[model samples]
Target: MNIAEFKKNLLQDKISSAQEWFFIISVSLLCMIVFISSDVFLPFLPEMTKYFNTSMSLSQMSLTAFIVGLSLGQIPHGLLSDRFGRKSILNLMIPMFLLATLGCIFSKNIEFFIICRFFQAISASACIVIGRSLFSDVFEPLKAQRAFAVLVPLVSLSPALAPSIGGALSIYFSWRSSFVFVFIFGLIISLFVFIFLPETKPIEKRTKNLSLLSILNNFYIMLTDLKLLYYIFIVCFSTAVWWVYAAGAPLMFHKMDYSAAIIGLLYLPAVIPYFTTSLIARSLLKTKSVNYILNIGINGMMISCLLLFLLESFNALNVWTLMISVTLVTGSNGFLLSTAMSAGILHFSKNSGLVSGLLGTLQLLAGAFSAALIGLFANVFDKHYYVNLTILFIVCGSILSYVLKRKVIKHEAIKSF
Candidate 1:
């Protein structure tokens, strides 16, 4: 090959086409449904207790079941997709999602409803793992980072909007209406994906052996790679911090005597920073290295956490301070999530399916654990728990940042030598 051909091959995603952009958007939209499934239930929690004739705690098991199913389903879906091909697996799962949505809508009892949500989350898991793997199949590291920078912010918006949509549906119609809304969404997405999205994983590249043991062994091997481990840690800590904030922020607002509606509006400011920082990240990737941007983001998060701690300790915590601190945390997340995912998946390109599955599984598991841990302490610590949780988040993030700097980043430099 000539020099030009070699350079072209070296830089993956050199050829940008309309079809590629459309495929990325379609996958992003598919992945967004996973968040929607979780968040839409948030507003329905109070009604759910009454609807199910159960205690609040028991009713909340629905969420936990969904989380478990979502986390556990990714590995199998990803493994199957790698063996069977992306299009067939995606087509199979989207319809299952639609069926699960319908089941949730009409269920007469809480147990059945929870079961349906579990299946719904399992089906949604396909979107996340396969969508990410598909990105790796088509784009190189830098281009994949750019694509995620755009995609992550859009997907993140589902949580911000879900409560509003859920609340409206519950007020105007019924709690059941929330599931109906999701069902209609599933129908539209299934049709769109079936008709338009092409199979990206071609026959030549499909894994010949489809065995559970092989998938698990590859998963374990990937976990042992130091660079991949750090990348996963970056995503885990970033997701944990967000879940901590999501769990504790409401209690802090309530202590300030803010009404539910007013408190809901506060999420808007926190969410705006995600979009702004994503735009900033996209622009910086044009000239800066991914490690540099990731370092800046992690440092920004640590500082934000420290500021939040001080503000709460001084009894100076208010909406503006809260907004600023939350913005820093969420904005940094926007950068970290996309960059970590791109860099991490690149490290395991040969096993993109396994890597994507492990990434999604650990990400959800970490977020769930974080949220649960914060919730356990919320009553005892009262409003101060938010400040303390932020500190914990920072402590965890700082360790990951050290690993990224000391190991992953330095290893790359040594490679150049």
Candidate 2:
């Protein structure tokens, strides 16, 4: 082809129509694949313990390693996309992810598996954050909310579906087979990203001085964005709830006599709310104002807490109460998630990648902290653990309320912008 024709082809490869349902679905699947890769190993943890002759605690690190990798790797990936361009950085992550998947399959022991799991987490950046940057680059304000509506369910489904998928694969096959399943997912998703996914960051969008100082400055700008802090609170706590749930579920399910097969089903009830909320969140963004959604989501979380306390008070918090509480907590946040993310990064339109990265990183950091606290309280004898957790959620909700009312400023952060 002539140079002119080739240029047209490149642009075609670099852009997608924002309105298409297929594009939205494609974005959702890409988002799901990363989360799926990150979490699909959990169900297999017990089995791997037996096969590897290791403790459950040791096998747990495989999960921890993935979080560590994802948390640390996102910033650099975002920064690189900002400097070089989103499309190429996104493309590069796909292969890295595939290779990491292969590492899981080839690992001979727990040692190698944990190492590869960390690498997989590190490489899986191709899916979630990078995909987010692409959507952030291409979509407009209200339409962007629509895109996130499509995106959140699939992203949320990762955790919701992971245990079932991991559990089933482990039961029928070997735990190793589950890792193999993730590898295939990585391969398939990598192909989709290569062919259909276009680069949203055009040449003109790229900037000079992708230096440490610039990245540091970008980080500072995000931290100080007063409007963004509430958004951060929204994403982080939404994430924190999941982290808390995941941290506590094994024992909670055990207490309920939830077998592996049944526990897989347990995740379903929670996921329904998450997916439902995505649609609700998208609609609210269009029909309502940001302040309105923020107000409702915070209060809704408080309402959920009271419901949780009621359930605990009666000691009737069986599977049904647990499921409903989890759903309300996740679903209500859906309305807030879109508003928070869209508003959070609006000020940094010029530094989309770095801003997205910082937000992603901060949210994950919040999740990691919450997960640790949950793990600490999840003692087998402590029946009040769930009640205590309900209180924690209330605390998070209260802080969010303050953030909204006070218009909390990032004093040190302001000068960077």
Candidate 3:
């Protein structure tokens, strides 16, 4: 080939590879946004409580408010993306997120700050709902499972990192500094998304009837699917366990006289197991069934619960024991979340946006409910009670997974006959 033709071919190859990487990274970042938004400022909750002269339980309302917004906001974004396309909805939401972050920074009262957080989470919800839909839109079932395996670990980093960042910011500046950091981060990501993220949902495939009745009908159909319902419940329970730990742990540590920074550093240990098991799940996907991986996760969680119970019964439920229990549960989650979500989305691939929204709604609502339960009952429950609550959620999740597995086996047996 001539030098000019060779140069053109090289340019084309570079563009193709760059575009692929950009898409993967962008989706992973998108998935992380809500998580970072939710947990980044948790280390500062005590600071926020004293600053606003609010009780700790009321201060925690801020987290609950954001989570509520995250859950409720997803449905409309999914519906609109189905009708207008993902890029347009995301563009609109990113600006709203930036604006809400500014509101959070400028708030003079606790109530106003809580309101701003609600809107912040509302806008941030677009990232996760649309991000997951993008994968479903592009990849088939098995490939999507592998993609989520990669994406989940990357996404899990937010919860690990956010607290440390928030702690440093709180120690040196103020809780408001965390909001400023989030604002800058959102602006940079928004620019990249605007420039590089392609519209995966095409006009030809767009849902035509986006009326209220139609939306409700779609929800009814999806909710009635036994398989999808099982997947959703499994996700809900697993997520609730994490949120309980996230919401309760800092307060417990603060009571133990640990500084915000120390509490933040404490979160780092759990992430290692979570990240490692996620990688293991990805490797196992090649030989093992999704159900097999899920069974392993369920058993891991059950073991964690038993350990927690033993620790509590022996009067040994301290920070170290709590950390070990949490690490095990989070590690197990590495196997559960991606496999369940990919399977759920693949089952309803044609309505990926709506299903994504439904899944996101239920998932975050579970978190919100768990967090709120801790906050509301903080006065009534001791630190060890939080561990008990975590154990309860794990047991519930294991039972659900077992039931689903049995149903699958029975269905297969009948088919074989």
Q: Each candidate's TM vs. the true structure? A: 0.90, 0.87, 0.85
Q: Candidate 3's error at 140, in angstroms?
A: 2.7
Task: Go through the candidates in order and give the C-alpha RMSD of each one to the true structure.
Answer: 4.7, 4.1, 4.4
lDDT of each: 0.80, 0.72, 0.81
lDDT of 3 by residue, 304-330 (tens): 989988998999977887888889988
| Candidate 1 residue spans exceeding 4 A from truth | 1-21, 409-417
lDDT per residue for candidate 2 within 34-99, as digits (tens), equals 678877777677777888888998888888888889888887887788788876876777777777
Candidate 2 matches the true fold with a TM-score of 0.87
What's the lDDT for residue 194 in model 1? Answer: 72
Error of 2 at 294 (Å): 2.2
Q: Give the TM-score of candidate 3.
A: 0.85
lDDT of prediction 3: 0.81
Score residue 82 of candidate 3 by CA lDDT.
83
Ten-residue stretch with the least lDDT total in model 2:
1-10
Which candidate model has the greater TM-score, 2 or 3?
Answer: 2
